[model samples]
Target: METPTAPGPDVPRRSLISGSAAMAAAGGLVLGAGAATAAAAAMAPNGASGVVQGARNGDERHPFYGEHQAGISTPPQDHLVFTAFDVTATTPVELQLVLAKWSAAMAELTNGRPVGKVQPARANGVPGDTGEAADMGPHGLTLTLGFGPSLFDGRFGLEKFKPAGFDQLPAMAGESLDPAMTGGDLCIQACANDPQVAYHAVRNLARMARTSVRTRWTVLGFGRASAGANQITPRNLLGFKDGTRNIKTEEDFAEHVWVGDEAGQGWMAGGSYLVARKIHMMIETWDEDPINDQQGIFGRTKQAGAPLSGTREHDVPDFHAAAPGGGPVIPADSHIALAAHENNGGTKILRRGYNFTDGLDAVGRLDAGLMFLSFQRDPEQFVALQRKLGSSDRLNEYIRHVGSGVYAVPGGLPAAGNYYGKEFFPG
Candidate 1:
């Protein structure tokens, strides 16, 4: 396979350095040629300092600094380990320090380098970095951080800065939310092509924040990519193509996913709101159902993933099309129909969801499902679409919303700051 290069302009020779030189500067750790190639490709377009490099393994790397966070718009990775934490800090200063450490560490890890200065094994007095991922490349890791509504409840004098739409999501119909799995004061979304790399990113961050925050919930997820030859769309646990009509281009992202300056609070100008739902699939029950019924639940053909009214997977569904008996071919209550943008007043969310199987439940059935990650300009967009699904989606019979969280993900780090959420900290 061809090696992936950073997407954009080339860097000047004056600012460029050899692979060995870069690694030596980054704590004397030796990196493979692939990692070196990624580092070289990530140089700033104008040859400015502080360019965030891509990961090793020839996987793409997203820049850590920009107007918006990387993972939100960066193409979705193959594996995800989403985590939420409850902040234990009493003052703004303490919270600021945590963000500083996390921001610095994130930049390094995403570049396929260890956190802080790497010490020799013999000098190990509380080593700065965990060595689990020492050999593993970055594997296209992207770490996204967000603040939950509860984080602004006057804890650090941030209640006044909370965005108007940032609040605890209202209880939607048909939800069996578990307290243990729901809500958090902060959230970190780690996505990578390798599961071990993804886990390592979150593990090290959690360790760094051990004193100021505690893990509230975590969900490990993997995606089933299309196989060779005929396979086309990625399948969910329910054995249907997922995210067929997802937002993809920059035009759609600007319209649907990214928050604008005029949208609300100044701090959230280019940021986006994230909605995470741990949807539990009743695998055994669904598997026992007939093929026709299974297809009916999602309103798409099982094998081809085309709408009932259309033959091709990418063909738009004629919602008004009729069947032999004059009924709507794509049923009104079908999963696709209810969640369609046209049905929801032109609203759409960028979905970067993943499939997960966590062994079995209390009854010995597969505890498999989708860790649904949706990024939108406003939280109300998710609310509107979800309310429709909860009340009428046919797929609801086979799934339950057990875990949910909404977070305000801020824009990317500024050119000078070395901390996440530094704008929120008082001078």
Candidate 2:
């Protein structure tokens, strides 16, 4: 369907919510966001901890130019298609010409190439690469791009660069949230290791911004529930083991995941702050509970995910060990003792979650869950660890958080004609 061009002379005309007036301009660029598997690349030439440098190769790629951004420390990819957009442009320079045509089509769909010319039996020709992931080589895809919070509600003057504690995501506690599956002004996550090459890269960037973006809510995840770099921890849908104390190395992602300069927004210093959520999982009431009450409601070890005060899966959790006709052998309302960043005062994030299903419901059950994702420089470190796991996490009695969002994600793309929020539209 490709037909939305025109925006060349250094990009910036503003007027169409049908208020008419036209005269766009343009430039180019790309990069950033979360991860999952395919190990052997702990990046760090100032790009921070990474992944996807080998294993499961279909030409494992990850490098849309960097210094931060390649799916938030690239490595996690075993499907995920996350979406969220809804910008329908009316200014901010037509949303910066849809981030300069989505940074020249996400630098050719994360280097597997092809943002155009898929002739599709042309009659008058309009294919522009929608041929369902043509050859699909780059299985380690990664596309990122974010910026919600009503895209800074002053409509497009961008409420003074909105990143200092970037809002929206408050009413916590076992959430039921569903305003048509929560908010969005723009987002795109797309990872790969193939689920149709991550749903053909967000379905060709929503069919090349079909007149300035619309699909606000997509999802689609699968497996790789969280684990990166030299991999291994992956199991959610309540089988435990998810991200086992995530935020790995690079000094724990520079003291808890990217975004520095105190996030007062110096172009969001090497950006980071996604937060998605979906969750649901009631899977027949957590498969009829009782496996020692589901390992004391996830204090761990539902088959070696370790930690009832530690035995293996990366050990370390001894939150005051005790339990012999006593009180604390892990269960401080366990979900790893309330998401243990050592009981939250140390606060960490960066999970990169997945695992989902969409099938039955009208009382048939099994709709399945956990999209969750993470990454944080300060989303109050996931709102103080989900307000202490939505008021006491005993794995919240079989999950329910139904869809939410929070983006921002703005670093990396320092070369090739620069685009994508190029510092929030400077001349």
Candidate 3:
């Protein structure tokens, strides 16, 4: 995959990093190439990370940051433990069979081993990634299987592929490998503790993945999955402002976000990621209000990340920090105040997520909302803090939680090579 190299034209700076990486993890967008520049600075600030660093550019006239990522919305509503599979004779098949055996042997719990109740699914037959029938390739088959919640943690007893540290655990079971020599193709995620539910969901996926591998249909590797509940990403709901507060600090940011140094290793550094989220937006209510009201809800102009009372879209808000005792300029309890944390001295995050509209309903209605997603090293400080800040803010009502999940986005495994502990876990 060719890495996107085109830098979007620079735009003026805004008060906060819009949909940043942390926002993405929270279900939000990806960062564009080079969004920061001098020309875009109509009125610069003392410390500007990047223009539209966290933005929602879907609105044409940029209610804020006029030219910054104007009118571009992030792709929304798709998330799975994305990986590319290379089909071959040696690949493992009968994962369901394995599940049946494991289930019979172990408890009904789901974990690394398969659950007992799984069925075979065909890659060439499945509707989602079935692809063009006429375009079969010769090198090796490519199969992409997106495991649902059931397989990993949807179920109660089964929590295979969930996130946790296993001391000295071999990477693989039959032919095990160590982390030093292996980047797992099997991505593990932590769902919201309903292991039983995750079991059923992923069990179905195992059958399909196993069958495809058996049939020499595909070799698996990570692909840029649309961020959702099961994948990790770098963007959010509104398009422009994503991944702004992501720590560029040498140790953590590089270790977590950057491709190789620590997170993935040298071989597969900078490789693509699997992003996922369940962004619950109250469209029924959010869109019902007039445009200005909508703007008020988000604290910035609806289409841009600007203060409700400010001009020049990206101009910094006068948070009434030094306002006269008479009035509230930006509204102390507004979404912007909660979002910007300006009163508390602006805190930010890295956001990468998507915008999706559940199919229109009877009244020509849509579940249009943001599948906000993001990733970062410390979820506590950045992500958790923001949630706490916005807890009682005005925007909470419309956006409520319907689903939530987390995944351990692993680094890549080298192709055609033995993994670490190959000696320990003999294949």
The most accurate candidate by lDDT is 1
- List the candidate 2 regions with Cα displacement exceeding 4 Å: 1-16, 20-95, 99-209, 212-258, 262-265, 275-282, 285-287, 291-295, 299-318, 325-328, 331-334, 343-347, 350-363, 368-375, 378-426
Q: What is the lDDT of residue 27 in candidate 3?
A: 31
State the C-alpha lDDT per candidate.
0.75, 0.73, 0.31
lDDT ranking from best candidate downward: 1, 2, 3
The number of the candidate with the highest TM-score is 1
Q: Give one digit per residue, the lDDT tens place, for model 2 in 127-158.
A: 65677877656677888888888899888788
Better of 2 and 3 by TM-score: 3
When 1 and 2 are scored with TM-score, the better candidate is 1
User: How many collisions per candidate?
Assistant: 0, 14, 96
- Minimum summed lDDT over a 10-residue window in model 2 is located at 33-42
| Tens digits of lDDT, candidate 3, 1-427 | 2111221222221111111212323432222212111111222211111232222221111011111111112222123222222222121212222222211111111111122212225454323212221111111111112222223332322243333331122121112112232222233321212223233333333333343232211111112223322223333333223322233344543444433434322322332233233444556666467766655555566445456567544477776644355555666667556555445444433344445455665677554555434443323323443455445566666664432333333332221122211111112
The sequence of per-residue lDDT tens digits that candidate 1 reaches over residues 94-175 is 5665676566557667766565333434554455567777756667788999999999899788877898757999999868
In lDDT terms, how accurate is model 1? Answer: 0.75
**Which structure is stronger by lDDT: 1 or 3?**
1
Query: Arrange candidates by TM-score, highest first: which order?
Result: 1, 3, 2
Error of 2 at 216 (Å): 8.2
